[model samples]
Target: MEQTEDEGYHKLDHQLCFPLYAASRLVTKCYQPVLDELGLTYPQYLVLMVLWESDAVNLSRLSERLKLQSNTLTPLLKRMEELGLLTRQRSKQDERSIIIALTEKGKSLKSEVPRLQQQLMDIGISKEEAIQLKGLLTKMINYISG
Candidate 1:
C-alpha cells in the first residue's frame, strides 16, 4: 500500500501531542517575563506555588504533587534554598525524609501571583473559553495519567 501526502499519519497537524507540546512551551514563554521579575524559572515557580498552598511538605509528597521525580526537584529546591526562598531539612517524624518549607521571601511572592494570573487571563481569549480550555486540558491530563 502506498501512503499519500494526505495520509493522517504523515501530517504534523494531525498528531494529538504536538499542539499540547507547543502550547505548553508558548504558555511558559508568556510567563517568562513575569517569573523573571521574581528571579525564578518556571519549574521553580511551580514548586513555590505548591509550597505556598501547603506550608511544609516532605520531598516525596512534593514530588508526587508536582509530578516530578525527586532527582529533578532536588536541584531546583537547592537553588531556591541558595536564594533564601525556601529551606530543606530532615523531617522530624521521619529522619530519612526531607521537608521543604518556604522562607518569608517565598511567602511574599504570593502577592505577585494575582497580577500574573490576570495577565494570563487577558491573553486574547474570553474568560469562558479559558475556563473551558482548562477543563478540557485537565480532563486530558487525568485520562493520560490514569
Candidate 2:
C-alpha cells in the first residue's frame, strides 16, 4: 500500500495566519511583564486604553470600543475596581445603564503608559516602521472589522 499525503495541513511558514497569530501572542507576552508591574492583564490594558481616551464613557460604549461583550467586561471591571483603578456605577437617569469612570489612580496611569509604549517601540522596531506598521494594522483591522 502507498502512503498518501493529507492536503489539510500546510507548512507553518507558508501559512499567513500563523504568523499573525504568533505575532499577536508574542506581543502580548512582551507586554506581560510591564503590565504585571501595574497589576493589569493584557485585556485590562486595552480597557484602560479606551478609558484613557474617554474618561466618562458608559459601559456599553466602552464595551463597543473594546470589542468586548458585557460578560467579559464585567469581570475585568470588577478587578479594576478592586485595584482602585476605576469605578463602575449605575447611571442616575437610567437604571439599565452603567458608567465607567477612572479613579485618580487610573487617570495617573496615563502618564506612565506613553513611556511603556516607547519601551515597546525601542525593542527591535524602528520608529518609522512602527508608524507604518500601525497604519497597516489599523487599516487591516478597520477593513475586517467593518
Candidate 3:
C-alpha cells in the first residue's frame, strides 16, 4: 500500500504556524490572571507598556509602535481612559493629532510588571532560552514585516 503525499504532511502538528499560534494563545492565557489583578486585558497591557516607555505619544506614533490600527486602538484607548488609567487629548500643536499619556495609575502599574514577567518565566524556560526564543521570534517578525 502506497502512502499519499497528503497523509503525513497534512497533520496540524507538522505545520510551522500551528505551534507558534498555539504558543501565542497559551502565553496570553497564562497572562490573564496576572493582568486581571490590575484590571487589564492583554492588548490593554501592551498599550500601557508602550506608554510607560514614552509617556506622551501621538495616536499615529502609538499605532505604529504597537502595530495596531487607530480604529482598533481608539476603542481600547477610550476604555483605558474610562478606567482612569490613561488619557487622550488633542495635541495643542496639531488639533488633528491625538496624544496619549499615562496617568498616575498607569504609571503605578510598572511596578507590577516584574512580578508578571516572573510568573510567565516560571513556565520552565531558562533565562538564556527565553532570550534566544525572543531573538528568533523578533528576527522572524522583522523578516516577515520586511
Candidate 4:
C-alpha cells in the first residue's frame, strides 16, 4: 500500500493547474513590451481586440465573449474611455444595457496586432504546433467552462 515519493500529491508538478497558470504568466510577460508600446495592459489589449472585432457590442455580450464578469469589464472600459480609445453609450433599445464601441484611436491599434502576432509566432512554435496547441487549449477551456 506504500506510494513512491514520485507519487507525492502535494508537489507543484502534480497539480494540473500549475503549468497552466505559469505558462499563462510567462506568455503574458512576453507580450509586455509590445503592449507597453501601445500603452495597454494585457487585459486591456484583450478588450480592445474583442471590440475591434465586434464594435458597438453590448456589455453583457462583451462579458460573455471575454469570459469576464460585467463588474470586472466596467472599470477597464472606463479607463479605455478616459484614454479616448473607446466610447460607452446607453443602448437605445435597452437603457439597462451599455454598448461599447472603439474610438478611432482604438481601431488604429488593430494595425499593430499583425506585427505583434508575427513576433510571437517567430518565438519557435511551428504553424502546425500552434494550430494543435490552440485546438487543445480551446477544448480544455470549453470542458472546464462547461
Best by lDDT: 3
Q: Kindly report which residue pairs in candidate 1 clash with one another.
A: none
Runs of candidate 4 with Cα error greater than 4 angstroms are 1-6
| TM-score per candidate | 0.90, 0.83, 0.89, 0.90
Lowest lDDT block of 10, candidate 2: 1-10
lDDT of 3 by residue, 1-146 (tens): 24466766677766778889999999999888889988899999999999999888999998887778999999999999999999999999999999999999999999999878866877668889989999999898878767
Off by over 4 Å in 2: 1-9
Q: Cα miss at 71, model 3 (Å)?
A: 0.8
lDDT of 1 by residue, 53-95 (tens): 9878899999988889999999999999999999999988889
Per-candidate local distance difference test: 0.88, 0.84, 0.89, 0.87
**How many clashes would you count in candidate 1?**
0
> Which 10-residue window in model 4 sums to the lowest lDDT?
115-124
What are the clash counts of all predictions, listed in order?
0, 0, 0, 0
**Residue pairs with backbone atoms closer than 3 Å in model 4 (clashes):** none
Let me know the TM-score candidate 4 reaches against the reference structure.
Answer: 0.90
lDDT for predicted candidate 2 compared with the true structure:
0.84
| Residue range 22-103, candidate 4, lDDT tens digits | 8789888888889998899999999898898877789998998888999999999999999999999998999999999999
